[model samples]
Target: MRPIVVLLTVLSTLIFPGRAEAATTFGPREAGVNAWPYHDGGQLPKKYTGVVDNQGVRMFVHPGITGGRKMNHPVAQAQYGLALVNNYRRTHDSWYLDLAQRQARRLADTHVDARGAWYFPYRFDFPLSSGIGLTMRAPWYSAMAQGQATSLFIRLAKATGSAEWRRAADRAFRSLQLGYAAGVPWATHRDAAGRLWLEEYPGPNPATSARVLNGHIFAIYGVWDYWNVTRSPAAAAIFSEATRTVYTYLLRGFRNPSWASSYSLRGDVPSEKYHNIHVNQLLHLHALSGQPVFAAMAEILHGDFTMARVTATIRFSGGTHVGVAFRSTTDGRVRARRGLTLGRASSAPVDQRRRIGGQPGFWYHVTKGALAGFWVQEFPGRRSTTGPIATFPYLTRRTAVLAKGSHLVYRASGPSVARVSATSEAGIVRLGWVDGRRAVLVSAGSLRGLWLVVTPRTTFRIAEGDDHDEVICGVSCERVAPLG
Candidate 1:
C-alpha cells in the first residue's frame, strides 16, 4: 500500500507539472533539452536592482533566490570569465575574447575596494559618485573569487603580453594574504579525545565561521595560479601550506562512507550534506598539484554518489540533469562522531542566519542546480598539468628541470650535444645549458618570459654566464646573440 501511494504521488507530479513546487519554468525558446530553471525561475524583486557599469559589465545581478535574496556570489563571475576564455581559445572568436578581457578588467577595476580588496556586494544602487556599499565588510576575502580572478588575469597577461594584467593579479593575491593574516581569530573547541579544533569564518561573516571544504579549495587555486605566473617563492610557500591544511581538516572528513558539507577546523563533521562542488574542487586540485591525495579524495565523492537514489530528472543543455536524494551511509541521521557537538555558535542576525541557512540551506539553494551547468560547461573531466614541466614538444625533449636562484643546473651521465631554448614575448631564443662546462646564453639581450630546455646531456647546470671570469675557458662555452 505504501509503495503504491509513493508511485502514485510521483506519477501525479510528473503528469501535472504544477504539482512540483520547486520546478523551474523556462520560456519556450530559452529552454534547452536539459536546462533547469534558476531558483523557481524568478527575476530580482522590485526593490533589489542590478548595476551596469560604463564598461558594459553588469554587477549585482544574480541568478536564483534564497531567503528572498538574489544570489550574486562572485565565484560565478570568475567561472564565467574562464568559460569565455576557453570558448575564445576554441573558436578564435574575437567576441568571446573581448568579453573575457572586459570582464577581467571590470572585476579588477570596478569591483575592487579602495584598499585594493575585492568585496562581494549584495546590492549596489548607489549614485555614480560614491561606490558599491553594504558588502560583507570584514578583513576576510573570498579565495573563490580572488583565485579565479587571478587565473583570469594571468591568462589575459599571457594572451596580451601586458604587464598591467600581471600586476593586477599580484594585487589580488596580496589581498588574499591580508585576509588570512588579519581576519578574526578562530573559536576553538575540543572533542572527547581532547583534540582542539580551530574554526575560522568562511569568508561571509563570523556567524558562518564553520569551515567548508569547497571554499578553501578556491584559495588553493588562487595561490597556485599566482605561483605559476611569477614562480614566486612566497606564493609557493602559501600554496603548499594551504594544500596541507585542506588535506588535514576538510579532506580527512571524507573518511566516512559519505562526504560532509561543513566541518570543524579540526576536521570534525558538522553537516554531512554531500555536495557536487566537492567533486569539482577535488578534480581541480588534482590537476593543479598532480598529487595522489586529491585524486583519492575525489574517488570518495564518486563512491558516495553511487549510493544516491535518483528522485527526479530535468533536461539541461547537452545532457540530462538528474536530481538525486542522498542516502546516508551511517544510518540516516548526521551524527557527530567521537562525542563532539554538531552545531556552532553564530553572531549573524536572525534574518542573515535564516537566509544563510534557508530551507535547503544556503549552499544547496544557490549551487545545487547551478553546479550542473558549471561542472558540465566550465569544468571538464581532465585538464593539462600546471607544473613546471612543459607539455609542448617544440620546447624540448626533457621538461622536468627548473631554475634555482642564480643558476639552473642540469647534468648528463654521458657526453652528448645539448640544445636548450626559450621563447617569450621578446622572441624565440636559445637558453644556456651546459654542453660541457660552457655557459650558454640564449641571446645577449634580456630574456622575458624565459623557458629553458636541454637534451643529450640528461644532466647539466647553467649559471647566469654574466661572469666571464667564472666561465671555464676551454671547458666552458657561451652563446649570446642580438635579438633580430
Candidate 2:
C-alpha cells in the first residue's frame, strides 16, 4: 500500500506539470507560521485562516484529501530544507535561506533523540514507541533524512555563524555512523545479532529485497561532508570503506559486463533507464579514489549509453513543445527536435560509436565559434588491455582529454606526463605510456556537463593527423593549430 501510494504520487508528478507551484500555494505561509508545518497524507484546507489543532500542531493538510494523512516526516523535512538551501544558493534569496534555517532548527529540536541519536516517527500520528517509529526510524530513512539535515545544518552554521546547528549536525552524524556495522560501513541496516544488512527493508521473499544503492550513496556523501567539516580521520575512513563496498559490490553487479541494458538487483535490466545520475555519482567517487576500473566503468556506462522507452516533453525550436520520446540507449532515436536558432542545431542523432583498426571507435562532436568538428577515438575493451588513448583538448572550453594506451583522460586541466606515472587511485582508470611523447588512454565513457581538472602550466597545439585525427597537446607541443 505504501509503495502504491508513493508510485501514484510519482506518477501524478510526471503526468501533471506545474503541480509543484499549485502544491506550494501558500508559498511558505500556509502552515500559519513562518515555517511550513508537516502534513500527514490528507487534503489541506483551501483557505489558510491560521487554525491550530488540539495538539498545538498547525493544520498542514493539503487539498484533495485521501486515505493516509501526510505528516512531516524527518526525512521529508530535511529534503525540503535542502531544496530551499539549493534555491537560496542559486538566487541568494534571503526568504529561502530563512525558511530553510527555520525548518532545520525544527528538525534539530524535534528529531534528535534523548540518547543523542536522531530519529523521527513514521508520521505525526504514530506514537514515539521504541524510541522511534519503524517507518520514519528505519535506518535507511533516517540516514537519508538526517543526512540532508546534517548537510543543511552545516551549511547554515557556516553561513550564520551558529554553533548550535553545527552541534546538532555532529550529533546526527554520530548517530548514523554508530548505527552501521564496525567495518562494513556500506550496509545501511543491521540485524539484532549485529550482522550487516545491505537492504533497508529486506522482506522474507528474495524478490522483495529493497536494496537500492541511492540511500547508501547519500549516507556516504553526508559522512564525507562531515569529514570535510571536521577533518576527522574516523569519518574519512568510514566514507572510504562505504565507497569501496558500493563500487566493488553493488555497482559491479548491477550492470551487465557487456554494458547493455540497465542493471538492477531485481532481474532483467530495463531499457531507456536514466540511472546516468547514479553513474555520475560513481564517477565522482572514482575521482576521489583514483581507481582506474571505476573510471573505466564510468566511461563504458556513459560512452555506451542505453535508452529506456519513456515519453517526455522536450522544448525545441525556441518554443514550448510536448510529446518527445526518450530512450535509454546511447544511440536511441529522437522523436522530435526543437529549439534551433539559425545554424545552431541539436546534435541528438549523432552516432558516437565508430570502427577503427578492427576495433570499435567512438567520435564526440565539438563546436567552437562558427566551427564544428568531430573527435574520433576507439572504445576500451577487455582484450585491448591498454591504457588511455592520447591526451588532447576536448572542444569544450574547460575540458581536456588524454590518451594512455587504450584508456582516455578527460580532465579539466591539462595532464602532466610526470603525474601520469603515479599509481592510479582505487576505482579510477590508470593511464599508461605508449611512448615518450605519446600515450594511449581509454575513455572514461559517457559523461556530459562534467568538468575535468587539469594542470595549469601545460600548453597545447592543434595538429591534423591521419584519418582526420587531430592532436591538441603533446609532450613538447606549444601551439594549438586548427585543422580545416
Candidate 3:
C-alpha cells in the first residue's frame, strides 16, 4: 500500500526515480492513472491467460465474434509485449525478458516493408464505418498498430541492445513519418488546417478519417519513445507537431460540456470501456508533459464517469426546428426563454465543425419533445455568427442523360456540399469532385462505402473528367454557378 501511493506520487510528478539511465522508467505508463497493461497470460506449460498459440507464436486473444473464446488480436499482442517488457523492468525477470523477445520476433518476422518503412498488416475482415476510400474489401492496417509495434520495438532495442530490434524499430518508426498522400499511405493525415494527425482508422481517405483521440495519443507516445531513445531532431519535431495537433482539436471538436467526450472527430459519445480509457490516457499525457490543461480535462472527465439522466425541459431559448445545426458554446450552456432564431443567439458562440455530410449539424439544446433536454444534432447552424455553416443543397447544373453504360460530367452550379454519390457502373469509378484548390481523391466509390462526402466542401465545381456512372446527387446548399 505504501509503495503504491509512493509510485503514484512519483508518476504524477513525472519524476523518474532512476534518471541515471537513458529512458529506463519510460515507455507507456503501465501503472497509476494510465495503466495500459496487457495481461501476461499465466504460467505456460498447459495454462495461459487471454493468450493462444497462433501456429507457433504466443498471441493475445479477444472474444471478438467467437463469444468467450479467443481470437488473435493485433493491438492485444503488441500490448502484451509492452506488458512483458514492463514486467521485466519491475521484477528483473529473465523469463519476462525472453517472452518479450518472442513476442517481438513474430512482429519482426512478419512486418510488411513498404519501400523502407514497415507496417504490420491485419489480414482479416474488420467492419469499417467512416468516410471515403472503402470498397467491399476492408482496409489493410491501422496507425494504432503501427504506433504500438513501434513502441514495443523501441523498448526492446533499448532494453536488450538487440540489433534486430533496433532495425525493426527503424523501419516501424519511419511508418509514422509517412503521409496520407502516398500511393499506399501509412497513417499520417494532413488536415484541412495543414496539421498532421496520426490516424487510428484512416479509412480509405483522410477526408473523413476516424481522427481518434486515444489512437493519436498512443501514437504520440511511440513517437516520443523513439525520440527519447535516438534523440533525433526530426523525431523530436514530429512529437511536438503531433502534440500541438491534439491540443488544436481537443476542446473545439472532442469535448462536450454536457455529454461524454467524442471518441473520434466524427463519432458520438463512446462506450464506458472506451470512455475510461480516454480519461486515463489524458492523465498520462498530463503527467508526461507537465501540462495543466490535460490534468484539468482529466479532472473534469473523472467527474463525468457516471451517466446523468435527462428529463424533458419545458422551455428552450432556441425555438424548435428539425435539421438545423447548432454548435454549442461556452456562454450558451444555460437555457433562456427569449426565443432566438432556433440557435442564433448573441450570447452563445458557435464553431464551424468539419464533416463530409455537407451541412453544419451540431448539439442543439432540445426542449419540447419526448427527447427534450437532450442536445439534439438539429438545433443550430441556421444562422452561425461563428463561421460557415454546412449546407446540403440539391445542386443541378445541365444534367446529361448518358447511356446506360456511359460516363458524364456535371459541373456544380455554385459552392456546394456533395451529399450522396453512386458508382457510374458496377466496378467503374465515379467523377471526382474538383474545386480548383482541392480534390477528394478516393480509391473506390463502392455503394458499401457511400464514399461519405465529408466537408471542406470548397466552392464551385465537379466533374473534371468525362468518366461517369449514374446520377451523383449534390445537396447544393450554397451559392453555386454553372461552369461550362
Ranking by TM-score: 3, 2, 1
**Model 2 over residues 93-130: C-alpha lDDT tens digits?**
67767767766766766663634556443333221222
lDDT of 1 by residue, 230-294 (tens): 78776766665565555544433434333334333323443434354565565455445544334
Best candidate, TM-score-wise? 3
lDDT top scorer: 3
TM-score of 1: 0.44
lDDT of each: 0.38, 0.38, 0.50
What value does the lDDT take at residue 112 in candidate 1?
47
The alpha-carbon root-mean-square deviation between model 1 and the true structure, to one decimal in Å, is 24.8
Better of 2 and 3 by TM-score: 3
Comparison by TM-score, 1 against 3, better one: 3
- Candidate 1: lDDT of 32? 20
Model 3 bad stretches (over 4 Å): 1-47, 54-72, 129-139, 307-484
Query: What are the C-alpha RMSDs, in order, of all predicted structures?
Result: 24.8, 18.1, 22.9
lDDT of 1 at 48: 14
The TM-scores of all predictions, comma-separated, are 0.44, 0.47, 0.52
How high a TM-score does candidate 2 get?
Answer: 0.47
